[model samples]
Target: MRDVSTLVSKTDELTYKVPVGLKRVPWIETLLLSSEPSIRSIEDTVKLEKAFHDASLFAVKEGYRRLAALNVPAVRPGDFLAETLRDDRTMAKVKAKLADEAARIKAVEDRKRVQAEKKFAKKGANKQQKKKFQQTPEDDDLKNLKTLEQRKDGGYSGKAPKSKAPKSKAPQSKGGRGPGGPKGGKGTKRSDGGKGGVRKSLFKKTSGGGKSSRGKASGRRFKAFFLA
Candidate 1:
């Protein structure tokens, strides 16, 4: 088999002399023939692609260099007359496909942007709601403080009436006796069996005497009864 490097050198030598339309076919045929045996896997396909890329770069550089040496512009001017390989109808179809692809990509980007905005907006709204809820208690406390200050300064007149403390019942002994002792009976004995019993009897005796003289008379009777 012919060496790939030798074929490359020969193709390069012929590049300057060959017509533009015919210059590319020889190099393409040469690459295909050189790699035919090894082009069995994806890796070989990638290598072929790399070779084509390098060849294209080399062709572009050589073409520009040649044009520069000949005092010719490398890029065709807008007004320059030339025939294209594709007909106008084919070019129109290609342009339409390219425009459709561009529109599809832009639509995808716009959808993604709208979705992102909605997601972030929802998060922001949730944050604001949380902040409002968190501040509610503090706001109520401030209002209560302001009302209290207004009442203290006599600026507020709609104050609630003070609640009265409930009246407490007098404490009684466990035996159901009052502070004075047991209720009336004929010299009733007290549970303590102390001077409290005598004092209770004396109170009962004097309680019925409305006049001071009657009370004194009852007191003398009590003294005599006790002595007896």
Candidate 2:
């Protein structure tokens, strides 16, 4: 993704900038080489320098585009062609600094790419080894079957001893005492039996019934009649 984006950016830069810059170069060169008396003046010299600078920038942009097309290491604007414009000291310094930065960035990206590839390779190798280790139980059964057939063809009367799988112990009841404990043996009651040997009710009704005033009076009158 990164490579593709960089290529796109370089392509756009070349498309827009290269043609105009190249056209100005020959025109600028002719003016600089002119024998006209006005060409040597300070004003014309400055204009000529500006023209040369622009043309150099264009050349550098083209170089970057070409490098990208050829799959060469990329160059930034800061690392543009310095030797082309001998009079521009600023471009030279900017180019040097950008070049160093670009180199550092490239080195870091290359290291990251290498590390990612190695990690994927290691993962693939581990998957292959795990697959090799995972032999099906059926393979062992097939070997045993072949051995049995060979024995029968040889007229051997004795049978091979069969290998038995170890039996798993049944899960113990959660509410009952385990194994040889007194409560677990024979007819002994389980832990659910209370200390008094009486079974507790699963639910009990609460007292404090709401007796109405009429019901209370009727009960007292009934008691009084019974006493008489």
TM-score for each model: 0.36, 0.26
- lDDT of all the models against the reference? 0.62, 0.57
lDDT per residue for candidate 2 within 1-228, as digits (tens), equals 369988988898765333464654433222233222233445554456556656656665766665676667864567555544464676666567667767999999999999999999999999999987896889889987888898879865777678898998643433333335445333224476432121121111225664447656566556533432
Report model 2's TM-score to 2 decimal places: 0.26
lDDT of 1 at 9: 93
Stretches of candidate 2 exceeding 4 Å from the true structure: 1-89, 141-228
- Model 1 misplaced stretches (Cα beyond 4 Å): 1-64, 67-82, 135-139, 147-228
TM-score of 1: 0.36
> Scored by Cα lDDT, where does model 2 land?
0.57
lDDT of 2 at 104: 95
Q: How many backbone clashes does candidate 1 have?
A: 0
